[model samples]
Target: MNSLPDLLRLLAVPAFAWVAWRDIATRRVPDRVWLPLLLVAGVALLFEFFTINGSPTRRFFLVRVGLSAGLVVPLSYAFWRLGGFGGADAKAFIVLSVLFPAYPAYRLLEFSFPGVETALGIFSLTIVTNAVLVGIFYPVALAARNALAGEVSLRSFVARPIPAADATTEYGRLLDVGPGRGGLDLDALRMYLRWRGHTLEELRADRSTYRHSRSLPEERNPPGDGAIRTTAA
Candidate 1:
């Protein structure tokens, strides 16, 4: 017979994998995706708690799970509030706290270390640590993609001038360039264009026509004065 812990571990693998995939694809995991896992895991833990018949190990396991939930949920919420984590990320960590309060008995690979075992006892910490370690590579990947696409030079990735035309279709804020650099404040540009009765479609269709009309924040002169230039990729 498979032990309760083993069975729970088996179920958690696919659940977490699905959450991970959804998060990658959509950048959001709906509550519907995590609710069932939380419910199932919570019920399983409760059942185990009552049925253990006064075993100290089982009691300790339950206590540890409770403590993990207490710590992880609030900490995740705090991160969400502070804008460090997305709502989906916070919810996923909270749910995983319930699902894997402690490490599984089965190891994916064996590494002998007392500290690892102790860390695994608060399994949610393991998830966060793993996530942070993985996240450290994201900027590198972004830099590589930008370099490959010629959006940025390999030698000076951080100093690359992103195209003003890229602002119309892309989803991020434009980098602020100082006065006299022919750089446009994207928000100000949009507002000025809108005030002059330009539609989004019109601006997108002829990005260059208005590129020279953009006003710098500190100096708004004639239409061509200190106008931002869009570089060709």
Candidate 2:
């Protein structure tokens, strides 16, 4: 028969693994996984009380376990609210606290005298293993997905804008009529000016408005206005 601490350790180890796997694969750890582990930890504690001969120190350990479990609930809720940890991660963290109970100091795993050192070692090992798995498999999976999809290289999709002059020339080529094409047609320009509600003859009568009209100054304003206002030539 496994001792109380041994069984607790075993239960906790696999719970940690399941939580990590859930996060890595689907980025989720459901309550089903951690809730059972929490119950198992509780049962392990009850088993310890029944099987092991009591001493004041053992009773104190029981108290620590109770306090750890108690603290886990609120801490988990707070972390979930703050977005620091997901529900499953919170449950996993709670399980770790219950399993290890000594904060700031980790416990080294063993049947007797598990302390903060072991907890730290377990935490460190878990991190390393998760890192190694992600590093090895993620890139390979990405490459395979890209290959199956027949993804093109990024360079092929790059779009550099043509220079402004080149862009204008290309547009002109499409609309080209012939060499020495005359400037804007008077009738079309006049119709467009009327559409914009501009009166060409009225604009010509005013120096300020005529100068600012869209038509060229010589074409629309002309020298006639100044010529008629003679200052003895």
| Alpha carbon deviation, residue 40, candidate 2 (Å) | 1.7
What is each predicted model's overall lDDT from 0 to 1? 0.65, 0.50
TM-score for each predicted model, relative to the true structure: 0.60, 0.41
Q: Would you list the clashing residue pairs of candidate 2? A: 105-116, 106-115, 106-116, 106-117, 107-115, 107-116, 107-117, 107-118, 107-119, 108-118
Candidate 2: stretches off by over 4 Å: 1-4, 102-233
Residue-wise C-alpha lDDT for candidate 2, range 73-175, written one tens digit per residue: 5666676788655666666666766555532232355443433354323432343335446656765665566555664343213222234323311211222
The CA lDDT at 54 in model 2 is 66
Model 1 stretches with alpha carbons more than 4 Å out: 51-53, 107-116, 136-173, 176-202, 207-233
Cα lDDT tens digits for candidate 1, 1-233: 34575576467678778777765543445678777887777876776677666689887887789788888888889978987678888888888888878765544356422235664488776777677677667667777877777776553333444565556433234445566565455545655654555645676687677566452235443333112333311
